[model samples]
Target: MSIVIIQGPHAHGLASGELQRNLQPLALAAGRTLEWFRCHELRDFVACVRSAKRRASEFMLLDPGELGLQAMAHPEAGLGDALDEVDTPYVEVHEDASTELGIQPGQHHAPVATVIINGDIGCSYRIGLGIALRQLDDEGIAVRAA
Candidate 1:
């Protein structure tokens, strides 16, 4: 079991660059490496989740950019439904409350998320990842890390 992150579309490359820098140490210490996917379309998100389910990931980290917006704009889109296909726990992450692009925490993705984090991009991911790792540990999945 390992970690997977599926993020929504974003124009800012800095967020990812910074996120990688912040996550590297955490991942290394955990004795884990993350598989990351940047989704360009909502279907891509579903497909990625299904893929994670197939792999039986320890947990999933989701950045619901357009997915959150889609959920709010059209509840019929079944974003939540798609997520339900995977039993893997998910940590929902959002950009800092101060400079969010389109989505914010507790807007729509709240109901299904195992944990919700809102803060600086890298920090939010850091916190979310930490929480996920701890959860895995608590569940006795492994102390090696989620």
Candidate 2:
């Protein structure tokens, strides 16, 4: 299975590295391929999401960070719109509770299977990858052997 990770502005630099390190082992264990894209701005976020759509990833893990909340607050930002276009199952991760960003479960403007690990970034990716692996397995999708 192939999965793409889209990191929002807040996940730049060190945070991005940490997320990759934490997600890699789990992805390998699941026999899944992982790709990552980091967005430093709303435009970058939109473009990366568009690229993911083009790539047709089987699953997506997004940590939209502050940019996502900002986009939700302002439709003109178009980040939510970009996300809405993706048909792949997705998991949204947040380092803080959705309420802190004025969001709530089932209220995300995009279609996602679930949101995970509200206050814990490291654990979020681990759990997100597990969810993806399970869903893929349930669907009888074959994961490449590591």
User: What is the C-alpha lDDT profile of model 2 across 1-146, one tens digit per residue?
Assistant: 58998877654333678778877888888788899987777778778876787897988887777676666677676655666677577777766665123334455444344455555677877777788888877676454542
- Regions of candidate 2 where Cα sits further than 4 Å from its true position: 11-14, 98-118, 141-146
lDDT minimum window of 10 residues, candidate 1: 96-105
Per-residue alpha-carbon lDDT of candidate 1 for residues 38-67, written as tens digits (9 for 90 to 100): 887777777787788777788888876646
CA lDDT of 67 in candidate 2?
A: 78
- Model 2 weakest 10-residue run by lDDT: 99-108
Candidate with top lDDT is 2
> What are the TM-scores, per candidate, against the unseen true structure?
0.75, 0.78
Residue 129, candidate 2: alpha-carbon lDDT: 78
Q: Which residue pairs clash within candidate 2? A: none
lDDT of each: 0.67, 0.70
